[model samples]
Target: MDAQAAAPEQNEVPTGAKQQQAQRPAEDLVWIDTPGIGQRGGIIIKDLRLSIKNGEFVYLIGKTGSGKSTLLRLLYGDVPLTAGVGRVAGFDLRRLDEESIPYLRRRLGIVFQDFQLLSDRNVYQNLAFVLRATGWRDETKIKERILEVLRNVGMQGTQDKFTYELSGGEQQRIAVARALLNEPELIIADEPTGNLDPNTSAEILRLLLDINHRQGTAVVMATHDYTMILKFPSRTVKIDGGTLHEVQKKTAEPSDRAKE
Candidate 1:
């Protein structure tokens, strides 16, 4: 990654970035509450009703097969359940119908560590494709949206650069921008900074925190970076021994904080 980061691209400041910086407070409801799952299984979330506030940062910590990703996936209706209910941005999981999945996805943003950028197209085209798929057709509007999202992710100049030519951080930033194109209410990031080094990882996490603080986009990051848990120290929600509770009980409001 360092080899690629030898030069930082000239990034342009976006007008919409400010709008994205402001976030509205969130209301509380049964976000992802699982009374339990299956008569005999390994996916029981157990009364795990959770709320990821309108603008919050939550770290989901747990070992492999601990259902961390499953819980995050549940928010966007990605995981089909054997039993249990979850809701996000007003969509219910128990009654999660196929018709409503698209609606639910529009309000949520998801980021993956692998930087799933299109290998063939340049940065601009990758983002352009997403905008078109989501219903934006105006050429002017599409370019504006693409530039806006790229600016928000701090990679405005890489619009013509191929993904393979970019550094790991840059590639990940593009993924983040793609996730932001829809301006989702909540962002679910799984191992977002996993492959980067300590310094690069910190920079990426700070960028995420900035997104959380500036735009009020509630973020749920499932990672093994307990060191980051100590470094940035946002509210934590650990799936230990199979249970969910506040990390410190500081913000019992339910909408804002969950951890420990």
Candidate 2:
């Protein structure tokens, strides 16, 4: 597909790169090695093992019902597996039942396409709600973090506005700002730009890339936009018929800005 590199000259990363990759830790690993759960439902995912490393920008390419969203929920502990195991930010997913789920999610930042913000709360209040709910005690730290993440998302001045008053891009930025409240090690995004225009989508991608670079926050994103994958090439994992394949693009360098 247009999203993948020309099938790789071979099926491996550069030798030294692979060595470094393998040397990394197994913790904070956001991937699903197996699937299927709940009383009424059977397995939705197969033995779907994937390991995304730290500071890497990865694209989850798959079509609808290909289990993209479900995969994300699994990482955030929203979906419990029937078999196999998953480790995200040092927490075990398979063993995490209702009680441990809160702790697992608190370590992660999740952004959704629908911008899950409260309509009744202003941007600042919305962020404050999460900070207080999650047990942030210091009033000063809460205010500081609220401002910090908002500034990170380029929405510091818009904090006083209602969610409905912002553009689609701005609303998404607020959602991202909220996600950053926990200072999470991993940021999971599901179709984050599905509703935005191309220009806005590029801005969001740039923001995500910047956060990934500055904070070394591992990013796992699910998207149907193969064109987006082509523009900013990175390690991509594709799922179809419950299979996993790692894609290594020729890889864009700073010198290849024109190509990008």
Candidate 3:
């Protein structure tokens, strides 16, 4: 592995910083404590503690099978919280029942590795389906919201196109548009750029950063692409040894030119 890709030092976040975090509970959009998360007959991670503040952008990096995806699933209510205290976007994961899962999900935006666009539907229809399912009854309002999100992701004119007709970058942009439909407080992305080339991945990452900067939506992303991180530095955590640890990179501050 390249030096930049090597695992970051564990437990490098200062204790005082951690203390400051505890004092600001109201700012955390996602909080977990000693969380027991996994499928039936098994738990992938144990005693995991995490707190993501409002409007912050963080990266989750780890090797394959390191419980990164499980953590993301737990946040979005896909996996049941078998043990421990958990909260996300104001919903308690420990108490989330099937009936309340949709309500919890509406407050979050989830992006998957593969663009999970409905193949039978065009971009407009795909977005409209979510709005309608989420109790968006007014067609005019739904169309306006869809158009706004599309424009935000820079995919405004492609609404009439099918998923197959769009490029991977464009499809991912649409996926992002779908995520933005609810104006979610947090966006949980799982290996969102895994399917794209480096250039395309850069585009998608930039788009996400723009959203984070402009909309003040908290973002937690899991990725294996360290180069992208090197290009766009932010608070990062690594999943290793069945635990999550903050990664303290020694890189210099990114130049404004790099951000542009």
- What number of clashing residue pairs does each candidate have, in the order they appear? 7, 2, 0
Q: What is the C-alpha RMSD of each candidate to the true structure, in Å?
A: 9.6, 10.9, 10.9
List TM-score per model, in order: 0.82, 0.84, 0.87
Best by TM-score: 3
Weakest 10 consecutive residues, lDDT, candidate 2? 1-10
Q: If both were scored by lDDT, which would come out higher, candidate 2 or candidate 3?
A: 3
lDDT of 2 by residue, 1-260 (tens): 11012112212233333332212265435655664433247555566778876666788887787778887887787777668766776666656666566666766889999999999989999998987777666667777778888888889888789989999999999999998887778999999999999989878877887788777788888887778777887778887776667767454542242234
Give the C-alpha miss distance for residue 45 in model 3, angstroms: 1.4
Worst 10 residues of 3 by lDDT: 1-10
Question: Sort by lDDT, best first: what order?
Answer: 3, 2, 1
Clashes of 1: 7
Question: What lDDT does each candidate get?
Answer: 0.71, 0.74, 0.80
Per-residue lDDT, model 3, residue 125, is: 99
